[model samples]
Target: MKKLISLIFTLTILVFQMNLYSQKIFPFEIKEHKLSNGLKVIVVPYNSPGIVAYYTVVRTGSRNEVEPGKTGFAHFFEHMMFRGTEKYSDVEYNRILKLLGADSNAWTSNDQTVYHIVASADALETIVDIESDRFKNLKYNKEQFQTEAGAILGEYNKSALNPFQILNEEMQKLAFTTHTYRHTTIGFLEDIKDMPNQYDYSLQFFDRYYRPEYCTIIVVGDVSFNKVIYLIEKYYGDWKRGSFEPNIPAEPEQKEERSKEVKYPNKTLPYLYIGYKVPAFDSKSKDVAALNVISELLFSETSELYQKLVLDEKLVDFISGEMPMDRDPSLFRIYTRVKDEKNVERVKQEIYNAIEKLKLEQVSPKKLADVLSNMKYSFLHSLDNADAIASTLAYYVSVTGNPYSLDEFYQTL
Candidate 1:
């Protein structure tokens, strides 16, 4: 334990130093700079030939929604961003992308909304200016706002058709009561239909959150980090920071374990999911690493229980578990598909027994090593994609305010 702690301390130091020497990162070089207005810039230089990916991560998501009856404003803005700016109309924006031979997409997660694009690096400046303009000065009126709100409602309708999304919305609502996580990011249908009534609030929302300080810009692939930084400074230097730090509520503790079942309109097979509150990601905490190891041993595919339950006996069609990562204690979710609802308790018992065995038995040496190795390979594989690497950095930055949680995580593992 002493050795492990010392190693963790040393790893933390290295990561800190690496980030500090932000003069110019090497081997997929990343240069971190803060604008006068507070937008964080991460420029990654790669020589992948023609293709480049530009990602803008806005640090506000559903977690930031705390107003009464305004559940999904963050996600709603994700739709509104495309409505248009004074300079770029909707058709013009789409046309420019087509002319530039670029494809663009954006998504809102629980903690952040990221706008991403890939094109020839020659179009980098245009993409940067367009994104900056949309973030800084958006143009939309009542008609556009209601139109997007209606579109979001349509999206919610489509998602409600999928039992998985429906149950997720139901499960999270049950798992959280006070925090905005209680509502699906798509929001309650009523609040969405009423979004137009809150158009003024929507404008305030944009001014309060969509600032340079709340955003991180990343450009990767076949680019010069030095040049990209200057370009960002030139185009986005004047962009302002958010006036108010989002007032996100902390979730209250779950006093007891909670379990729920959802029978969908299209139910054919039975699904069981259990959510147990778990500790958050504390890279410095050994106990967090232990929980990670515990989850891997219990539910990872190579584990004996998974083999017995899903591969050999076929009692379960599939099984998976997640310590739903968060800035606070999130749920450790156990998901399984069984023969029928009658088998739910039996499946639950088997999983509980597997967990119980951990207290009575330290995992086998091979199993423990396999679990760690699996995580290492997966983390390494994820770094191969430029977009994946950027988004991963953005998530850690948004969630923990420290991007090197990835390194400290491995040290604990």
Candidate 2:
């Protein structure tokens, strides 16, 4: 009877994995429900025996800031959320989660903040209750708020001393004149210094965002959609709606390309940055696929450029570039450090030539096909765990509202 039961369970898991790519099966297999108050719920069942991952994504970030001197409130709350709620004190929450064998944490980024927990499937409902309570009724005394604010300031100070972090802060400010993206997600030092005094603004900040409408819940692993949705409705249904939307100033077009050279006399090698702003990620954009291909051909160590710049000639420390994943248009930046200043323009021209060649016949059909095939296979290879799958879903959902674009992304090739 045990062997029969195990065989039946194996068949059931196979059925769900097969239906993962089906359109008609989409709603029932991996459910999405929106509450009357506009909260979004995503229930993903994996039946991976005993584990589950639950995440609440709030769609407010540093980009949502509009007040002149009060940037990074979204980031500030990432630290504050742990301080405590009226009902669930930090110690008590941790104690309860530990009792249930759950591990949880939260993160704030340029576009979103996600609070998450992973645990035995048995603890799913308890996790829901704790998170929903705080989302609706988070309360902190002034002293606690002030205390957390100082910690955020200290966190900022530590990051500011990092050379890469310092460069990015200055780079964003220079890249954008009017857009909120001008400031780093941590905001400017001058602004964060005054954050604690703006207590009233902090309260208003919570009121404006962090609403049911501004958040989405994702639950994955050994569970059923009905049970997860039922848990979501029980806990999150009554949370208030969000009324505010951010009005970040639109970035003006760059009329001419620009380059900057700053001698951080503290460094042995000179740092160089080459930047070009591009429209952000959109599901229908195959150009993004093309950009990925271009980057692979030009920037990888296997590429001719890397060997020439760093190994053959020993002119540059390394050549690297990245295309950001964002809901708003972001920059494609090429950064490198040279052994000496004499070869800066020479290396920059080579980088430009590489980009220009991508527009020409730079890649063979077999090579391009190999890259695309490798990309798809590599993505699937990482889906062996519940958290890996959930995190991948979260990444795409954070960029586009949809994650199943994984299919269309490959089909576009």
Candidate 3:
């Protein structure tokens, strides 16, 4: 009777997942259009009555910083973009944003830079005009550029003070040989210092990347798709496409495990990160899904490893794992903060043991089903607001150049 019950439960999960996969998970209808110059625009009309989220997803980041001595421009633009255009000075831009009651910010990652604005729905057209003008007409004199460069150096020095930052910087430097991922998004310390002197190179960098061909606009709110498209075309239509394409170097496979040690002067608990080279993210691949499940199974609080190392053995204060979604092959990393220096080796060995066990056995069907269900529920729950919806779609759009990729990704699970 117990066996029959288990079989019935397995069948039920299988049926539910099958039905879910056959349709889209995004509740709203996503409307899309591409300008003649290659700027992709996406709109999601939600029930929210008075607010909107605008995102300009630039499909360029430190990953495209492949040329020697040219790293960090992608991240630099995150600051430079706010310097404003000739038509709208920095002060005017700030004042306008304040008038509209908008919250705006931008961030650069390994594979993309995203600028977002959340404001009253009535201000959508003005927001569109300001964003379009800047992307096309961004201007900064050498003195202004140099001032920002100095600020970046100051920011970098401050970040260097953090042990966690130092560890992460060292880990990436050790992990990759030829890929741009070897450096942090902030680029090399030397390049950032030299940035002010490279005024000509700066213009070229913007010319190459700040083009319509490399950008996408996403708006989600209580809005109309037609009006959004019209406003986007009116403001951004004339932006020209550039012919430059960056040749990012492919990362070579690791033949042996790599290790690095950092001894910070500041006294703190020793932390360890063990990363295994993994394939690039593919939402349709079973291997990626299986790997994601394995990450949660081995390191989540519910895992036996966590119970042994933290709850009973008391070797670690915190332990977690991540398999980040990326456009290129990346790492599946396990991180731990150890309570005692002496227990570091023991904790590392236990992590290795967990990996070995996973290789030798399959996760039970019941457990796998539970994790997948929880993941789906969490994803659905995250889409509870306009900003959440736009941010979610922006991520998928950056990865696959299609917002519907989110639907396919969830269905794959």
Candidate 4:
């Protein structure tokens, strides 16, 4: 009996020490530099032997499309950027990528567009040269611009086939009244239809947002910080900065609860989404931490609600909740797919009941500690490779413009 007590006490001490160590969650030294031209660069010296992940985060998304008729230009640029610059034609760019055996792609979201490449470390110089050239000297004629626009229209049509996509579009339109978040990242269908005729406007959009001040370069892997900076200076130093500042409109407060129902053209299991207006992502906010905790406590697979709704009653095949990190105020959304259409209301009410229980009752300290520890360790386990580390930091850098915010956020949790 005495030995058992002693072992338990030692384990407790070890856990306490581990929790203290985890306060500084980011294991690598983050080196940052700013250029005279207003470009920012972040370097992480990861242990990968011969590979690196390069990411360029453009802080413009559909949220920056505030003009009357230009809603899809940001995503359009995601496609157009690959059309290649004057120095590097699309064919030549593809050839070079194939030579280096590189994987490269770009994606646009509500708040930012990110371009990423995973390649050998030896190819870093060529990567910098081509990327800098494209950002600084990209040129496309009217025909090329219109071709990409039409392609985007086709892409939009394809995405519209998904019922969840339709529901998300309606939700955004219903959620915000004045903010550009009223539109999805793909923008509206009408704007995409009009995109082919807006070749001149496309030039202006690129000129406005593709500037040094609105971008950040992140390099993670077996790389030296000083070497990365020197290469950046050699290639991107002469690139001039632009003086465009977007007037992004702020969303106003919701005075009352709002709901909308979206109908699907094809038969499918009924999906239910409930979103509550929540505070924006803040690294130091206790409210944000609490929301994160609540998401797990009330909706995780082990939660009473999930056990009842999914395991016991077998009403829902899937149910989950998330507080997505966004630069501006976003949703704390609970989502579920009901097996039967008639049970949608019951599932929703059950979720409400679970939320009310969370508000009325306090979780035991042991459970809270367990959840926090799991969340922290799960994140730590994901940083196993260069690409994973860069990808994780890219999202935080997009939202907060500081990779260190990950440490601050986890500390709060």
Candidate 5:
């Protein structure tokens, strides 16, 4: 235990030195503004001439799903937004995207929904006009709503086919009680099945969560702040603010271990997943930073367990650890795929032993430095393009309302 504490002290010193060196080199000249309607816009000018990345981040997701019966609307809106506005039918929107040579997509998660497009810099005005129309004047009939609901159910069924997805669903259900995080972003199966009949409720959900106050528009690459801001204000100015605020219930502390078992009907390798409750994300917190490093220290491929169970003994086909940055307290999960059913018990013991070692002794300085350096360079390398940079900023913006939180996060490491 003293060795473990000493390791923590060493890691803290290393992180402090790294933070000092990084303080002088902030990555981007991020300019931010807020419209009267409470819509935020961030502009970053990069050297990539004649190309731009535009993003609309809605700060609502499964986390806003407080009602028991109306659970899936957060994800439902991801599909609904594509159904198009009164001015542009779904077919017309596709045609517009094709003509402009734009790359576009959207995704929903535990805390936010993001819609994005990459297109020629010259098409900025057209892109703004079309995207603004959908957010402000989106319109759909009951028939359209029902059709999308059916499609969502189909998607849930498809996900159920995957054993990993099944495990994740069960893990979430077992780990969380009162918190909406208990359900995946796809939401409860029953909620999705009944979504078709909740057309009116769908409209309410959009009105409550899709307001201007809950959204941010991020643009990076060959663009001027003046031009982007002017265009956004002109297009999104009339979008109204909302007064509703969701009182998301918090998950109580877990006092004992939780476990579940499953038997896939089809013959397949046995799988195991374990989750331990952790705190809500704070980019500057040392505890969160340590947990993030512990994930690497204990389970990363260079770690002792991976070398023994995966590459040497070959008892496991796959193994990984995840510590997600989330708006609420979440789980630190370990997953393993055992090659043979008979080896499952031994593999579980080995994993437990690895955790015990982590709690008892400190990781080597060499291993800590290597993992931290690799993670640093990995992030820097990912900034090779405008889309990548924009995507990275969108994530931080959703988490802390400031893209600079990315810097603060790495510094904490």
Candidate 6:
């Protein structure tokens, strides 16, 4: 008994040390500067020679669309942002990017919209000038706005063809009653169809959300913090802050479980998604940490449930679960696609059984330690390049408006 106890104690110390060492994996110093206009600049001096990943994170998304008919405007702006400013037309912007051999794109999510560019370090000044100009002086007529809105409607119709998309739409709608999360980032089909008529409203959406107060500029690569800050100030300093605050309605606590079935017009394998209401992400919360651990323990590929349903019985094609960090309370979801419709119930029961086992039995300390170690190392391994580091930080920045939250969240894990 004494020998077993000593061994466990030693193992615990080693795991603690490993986690501490892993915390240092984010090797570069993160320098942050806030402009007087409320724009934040985060610079990470990575060792990648002559390459830079520049990201502009706007802290607004479909979640800000609180009014009834404005659901898809946030996403619509993702497309419209490229329409260019008075200084640089869409054609001119493309020509300049091609000249610099840069790759640029933008994406919108439930909580934020991000625009990213990967270019040479020397082109940073031009990058800042163009990006800042677009944000501050974007110019588009009703014709251009309507054209993009129509394109978004077409994109929505194309996405509806995917069964999983339909399932996700149904799941979100069934999960919440009041929160804007009830809608997908692309928003409702009806709202998307009405988008063309909402061109004037689109301008208002931009005016409300596209401001220095709601923006962060992240520059990662072989860059100097002083130089980055200087360029940002020179270009983005005069941008005015807007006073609009979204009056997002709080979601009432769910008292009962909800379920919905989405019928796909096209033939496809049966899909199952089960979600439980989880709290807003807090890096210091033990409850949130436990949810992350439980997701891996019950559903990851190494879990007993996965071995039984996927490898042994061959019932499910894939099984996974995630409780992604969000600005507001969100769902911890388990998803699977069964090979046959008849086995869907069986797979669901097997997942439930796994959850019950976790509740009834304590996981061995050694096993728990191993899971934590793997999770830490997996994340550390992904920070291999400048773009990867910036992209990773962008998500944390969008959620909490702080890049260091990544460290806090990892430490909590």
The most accurate candidate by TM-score is: 5
Residue-by-residue lDDT tens digits, candidate 6, 235-328: 9999999999999999997776677778898899999999877778887565676678777777888989889988998998999999778899
lDDT of 3 by residue, 35-57 (tens): 99999999999988899999999
lDDT of 1 by residue, 55-89 (tens): 88888888878888887888998878887788888
Every candidate's lDDT: 0.75, 0.75, 0.85, 0.85, 0.86, 0.86
Give the runs in model 6 whose Cα sits over 4 Å from its true position.
1-25
Score residue 337 of candidate 2 by CA lDDT.
80
Candidate 5 per-residue C-alpha lDDT over 97-168 given as tens digits, one digit per residue, 9 for 90 to 100: 999999999999999999999999999999999999999878999999999999999999998888899889
TM-score of candidate 3 versus the correct structure, residues matched by position? 0.93
- Clashes in model 1: which pairs? 46-222
lDDT pick, better of 3 and 6: 6
| RMSD of candidate 6 to true structure, Å | 5.2
Pairs of colliding residues, candidate 3: none
CA-only RMSD, every prediction: 5.3, 10.1, 5.2, 6.8, 2.5, 5.2
- What tens digits encode model 2's per-residue C-alpha lDDT throughout 1-413? 00112322333243333334533212214678889998888777876788999888887888888889999798988877776687898888889889988888888777888888889898888888898988888888788888878887899988856666777887888788898888888888888898889888999999999898778888889988889888889988888796788887889877765556554535555667777776677654655545555556678787878988989999898888776777787777778888788888898788877665554443555665566556566777887777776776776676676656655554544
For model 1, the superposed segments whose C-alpha errors exceed 4 Å read: 1-28, 261-263
Q: Is candidate 4 or candidate 6 better by TM-score?
A: 6
Number of the candidate with higher TM-score, 3 or 6: 6
Q: After superposition, how far is residue 368 of candidate 2 from its true place, in Å?
A: 0.8
**All candidates: TM-score:** 0.89, 0.88, 0.93, 0.94, 0.95, 0.94
